[model samples]
Target: MRVGKASDTDVEQVGTMREGKLDQKHLLFGEDDSPNNYDLNMGLTGGGGWRTPRHRHNFDQIRYVIQGELPYTETEVLKEGWVGYFPESVHYGPQERAEGLRTMVLQCGGASGQGYLSVARREAVNAELNKVGEFKKGLYHYTDANGVAQTKDGSEAIFEHATGGALRFAAPRYTDVIAMDPDAYDWHKSQDTGVEEKWLGRFTERDLRIGFLRLDAGAVYQAGQFNSIEILFQTKGRVTAGGTEYGPETGYEFLANEGPVQVEAVEPTEFLRMVLHTF
Candidate 1:
């Protein structure tokens, strides 16, 4: 088990690999050797906001809007307090986010098991690619040996460069992005006293899940019951575990069948929880 406080994580400015100016706080990172390697991060859009072209990836992503709104496309927008599941191989976006938007995102390998490419590796390759080509407006512009100019998606370019092959996406399980409204789902009483749950959805054959958990003040809950990795991000209230106190924005990770960990609510608390894809 690992616990991460948002304040302890360093902030980084996004690179030119994408056409945007955003600050990112990477909170928790999984093992690089595993296909299920993942990164959980909080991103903030500054003054002019950020932009990403219409694109897709081989990995899955779950996004929750914490503040302001996210414009995923020119027409489709996710208002604050919304959750979206972006599955592998499904295209979305030409995003034009508004300033002061805050969002938390979890990026991981999907059911296809292609795995996730680390941001560190991507940035390193981007730097090398910059010497040979230029990234412009979410695309890479470069010249070929035949003396011809060509353009490729910047993300695809970096993946190919890093892996020494073309990036191939699996057949999409969902035709479009799945947008969810947590408020629309009613919380159900859990078997544990003083605990309630709202499970939004479960996806793919790998059984990736998205849900929320609530604990009343003074309630004690046993966590880490899932067959896969379980991650919890405090959305509100305070809790204590193993004599340590945790507040909002703090993250916790429990590995598969890692056994139970007791969490006692010092005050009424709510958490956004996810069970990563089973490998």
Candidate 2:
């Protein structure tokens, strides 16, 4: 198990096809050189009128709004504390926010086995592509070897050309976006002592699991071994694990078969946990 605090992560500016000056703090990343690798990032938009072009990624993404509001559809908005899931190849936005926004985002491979590219890597590729092609209206435009003009989805082109042959074509896990308000859900007590959980959603095909856990002060929780990738993000109070104390915004990743992880609540604590099973 690996534990870390959000304040300990380095913050960097990562430009995207979006319209804002965005900075991000990386919380966790999957194993190196693995197609099944994933990334977790905390993003903060600086400008008041930030926006992103209508775009899609090669992998699936889950985002939780920590602050501010963002438009999800023509008639819908993702307010603070809401969560959203964007499946691979599913188009959704022209997302925008009138004020600054802060969110936690998770990007991982889809059920079809398509790989995910890190935002930093994608930014580097976009820089190179910018010299040869122009990204406009969410599409990349350039002349082919035959001098014929061509246009492609900005995200698709970036994935194909930037990482060479690392990515493969695959069917998206879902065709539409999923959003939820945790406050509207009920928390159920788990078998674990002093621990209560609220299951958000699970995608069996992708082996994706999302949920929240609440623990009483001085409670001890044991995370049993599993053939999967498990991640915990502290949202309220404090929790100590593996000799490290973590507060809100902190996160931890537990490896597969990593024996029971002991987590102690220094106070009444609440956190979000996500798992991606291998089976």
Q: Which candidate is the best by TM-score?
A: 1
- Give a tens-digit lDDT track for model 2, residues 1-279: 876667989988765444556778988888644556788888888765566667666677888889988686666787899888787777777776665688888888766665667666788888988899887656789999999999877777787787676444556556678888899989998877899999889884656788888999998877746577788878889888879778899878888778688999999998888886464
The candidate 1 region of ten consecutive residues with least summed lDDT is: 28-37
Look at candidate 1 and tell me the lDDT of residue 131.
Answer: 98
Report the alpha-carbon TM-score of model 1 versus the true structure.
0.97
For each predicted model, how many residue pairs clash, with residues at least 3 apart or on different chains? 0, 1
User: What ranges in model 2 sit over 4 Å off?
Assistant: 165-169, 277-279
TM-score per candidate: 0.97, 0.91
Badly placed stretches (over 4 Å) of model 1 are none
**Candidate 2 whole-model C-alpha lDDT, 0 to 1:** 0.78
